[model samples]
Target: MTYETILLAKENGVATITLNRPPMNPLNSQLFKELGHAVDEIAEDNSIKVLIITGSGSKAFAAGADVSEMAYLSPVEVYNFNMGSRKTFDKIENLGKPVIAAIAGITFGGGCELALACDFRFAAENVKIAFPETGLGIIPGGGGTVRLPRLIGVGRAKELIYGGEMIDAVTAEKLGIVTKVVAVDVLMEEAQNYAAKLAVRPSVAMKMAKESIQAGVNLDSSSALNYENQCFITAFASEDAKEGLGAFLEKRKPNYTGK
Candidate 1:
């Protein structure tokens, strides 16, 4: 598909989606529409085992949602826009395959929320992340309010959201917001390598594990454990599991076909 706001490239079972509105890659309605289409394309491709999302240039992962697009909208229009973005981010977060956010430069507001939707994140050492929505007389309408607290605890999420303060990569790493932080030049390389590693794993098992973990997080302990056990058995029944077991006993690496 032709994409104006983003670029999609696939190689070796890994698909990378680059936000392409140069400079800061501000999120606008068109960008969100293209992103939804991209995700749908990825979802239909069986060979795509993992996905990576990042923005163009080293200046920013994304500065924030396009403020100009929001400067003068009716309340209904704002609600519609928020819902569209929320749905896109939710699709990313709950995708059967793993998703990684390769972040660099400034990541604020909706940008930060977008990264939070990914299963993992790798950021450049100079990355700055924050939710500055409150200062704009708004709030994170893109699932940030729910996901941030779940990721970094309620107190910390509240503090950051309420103050609209930005934190550097090191602090973000320390707070568990990013999977890892690397030098600016190696940010993409690191994230791609990680995605490649995940892509080679037993696909069915990996997807099951991801789903189990995500669902478990929101359920009661007893219910979560029961659900996890069911997911485990489902994975155990896959052909990949047989291959994994056979290869283990043969003292050789498993060649999973994603069966």
Candidate 2:
């Protein structure tokens, strides 16, 4: 299907999905539905090994869901809105392929939630981001209350979510909200550089590692180890593993087929 709100490009086993809504780039319900479908397209394409998400303009990654749209929602409409967000967020979090969020400018509320859903995040030096849900007489229902706390800590997450204030990129990196930061001029380049490198890695191993880490986070030590062992076995069973080891012994680069 043709997408008016986003752009998708794939090359060298990397797919870049750019949110194209202009001005403040608000995340409306339609955008959420399109995002879910786009992410699924990227995930199902076996030739794509890495996915990078970013904004089309330099002004805002996404300022949040269009607040104007939320002005007159009933309880059922609110439920539907949050459910769409959760569905799209799950698309990111559960993707077998690694997804990197490239935040260049303002990212708040649902946008923050979207970035958090990705496996990795790279932001510009002075980029601004926050939750700001509490200030609107509601709470972060798009997994911000849950995911933010997991990334940073309960204390810091609570403080940010409670105060409804923005944080700079450096602070976000320190708080674990972002993995790295660069200048605004080179933010997308830097993020794409990292993503390109990841694209060449063993896709099977990356998928296994992601699963292991995700499972480990919500389980006890013993249960986590069991999950890791299962992932380890799965990784070893892949064609990439055999090629990687044999190529290593032969002093050559291993080619993976994502088998």
Candidate 3:
């Protein structure tokens, strides 16, 4: 499928979706719709084991939502727009396969929220991340309020969101928001290498593990354990599991078919 706001590429079990708008890839309704379509395509492709999301230029992964678009919107229209964005981000978070955010430059508001949806975030040394919505007299309407607090504790989340302060990549890593920080030149390379490594793992087991972890986040200890056990059973029943066990006994590498 064709997209105007994003570019999609697939190879070697890894798919990349690049936000094409340069300088500052502002999330507008058109971009959101295109992103949703790209995500859906990646989710349905069995050969694509992992996804990496990034922006076109080094200037920004994304700056924020298109304020120009939102400025003229009525309360009802803005609410609907935000709801659509929330749904798209939710899809990214629950994409079944691992998703990595290769972030650089400015990441604010909806941009920061989009990165939060990914399973891993690898930021460049030049990256600056924040949720500066409060400064705009608005709050994060793209799952930022919900996911950020859950990720880095309420205190730190509040510090970033409420203060509307931008933190460097290292600071974000120290706060547990960024998985790793790399040189700006090697950011995409590092992310792609990591994605390649994950793509080679047993797909069924990986998917189940991802699902278990995500589900456990909202579940109680006892219920989470039960759900994890169920996920384990499901993974254990896959053909890859049998091959993995046989390979272990035979002292050979396992060949996974993603079954």
Candidate 4:
């Protein structure tokens, strides 16, 4: 589908959704709608094993939500808008395929929340990330408050959210927010290469593992273990599992059908 605020491309089992607004791809209602559509497209395509999300220009993955549009919104309108954004982010988080955020330059507020939804975040050396909503007389309404604490410690999450200060790529990595940091020129390349690697793995196993991890996050140890065991059984029953095991015994490469 053609999208005004984003570009979607699929290649070699890896799909990329680029936020097309240049300079700083600020998230707006239109962009959020387009993103939701793009995500739906990716989710339905069985051939697409992984997805990478990034911004068009090198200066920013996304600056934040479009404040100009948001400024005039009424409280009720804002609540609805925030809920829509949260739904989109939640969809990305729950997408069966692994999703990677290729972050560069300014990533703040809603942008930071978006990255938090992805399974992995690959930031460029020039990346600066923060949740600066507090300065705007609000808090993160896009699952940031919930997910950020789960990612980083609660104290650190509170510090970042309350202070609304940006952190450099190095600091973000040290804080475990960024999976890896690379040169600006190679940021997309790194993300693509990693996505390609994941694309070739057993899709069923990957999906099961992702689901297990996500679901286990909210469960207690015993319940989580039980859920994980169920996921393992589901993966073990797939055709790919048979291929993988047979290939291992036969000393040959496994050709997964993503079943």
Worst 10 residues of 4 by lDDT: 78-87
* Error in Å for residue 138 of model 3: 0.6
Segments in model 1 whose C-alpha atoms lie over 4 Å from true places: none
lDDT of each: 0.93, 0.91, 0.95, 0.95
User: What global local distance difference test value does model 3 have?
Assistant: 0.95
Model 1: worst 10 consecutive residues (lDDT sum): 78-87
lDDT (10s digit) by residue, model 3, range 1-259: 6799999999999999999988899999889999999999999999999999999999999998999999889999998899879889999999999999999999999999999999999999999998888988889999999999999999989899999998999999999999999999999999999999999999999999999999999999999999999999999999999999999999999999999
lDDT of 2 by residue, 129-165 (tens): 9889899898988899999999889999999999998
Model 3 TM-score, 2 decimals: 0.99
Cα miss at 146, model 4 (Å)? 0.7
Q: Which pairs clash inside model 4? A: none
Q: How do the residues 115-214 of candidate 4 rate in per-residue lDDT, one tens digit apiece?
A: 9999999999999998888988999988889999999999999999999988999999999999999999999999999999999999999999999999
Q: What lDDT score goes with residue 210 in model 3?
A: 98
Clashing pairs in 1: none
lDDT of 1 by residue, 1-259 (tens): 6899999999999999999998999999888888988998998899999999999999999999999998898999988888889889988988899999999999999999999999998999889998999998999989889999999999999999999989999999989999899999999899999998999999999999999999999999999999999999999999999999999999999999988
Runs in model 3 deviating more than 4 A are none
Instruction: Provide TM-scores for the models.
Output: 0.98, 0.97, 0.99, 0.99
Model 2: CA > 4 A from native: none
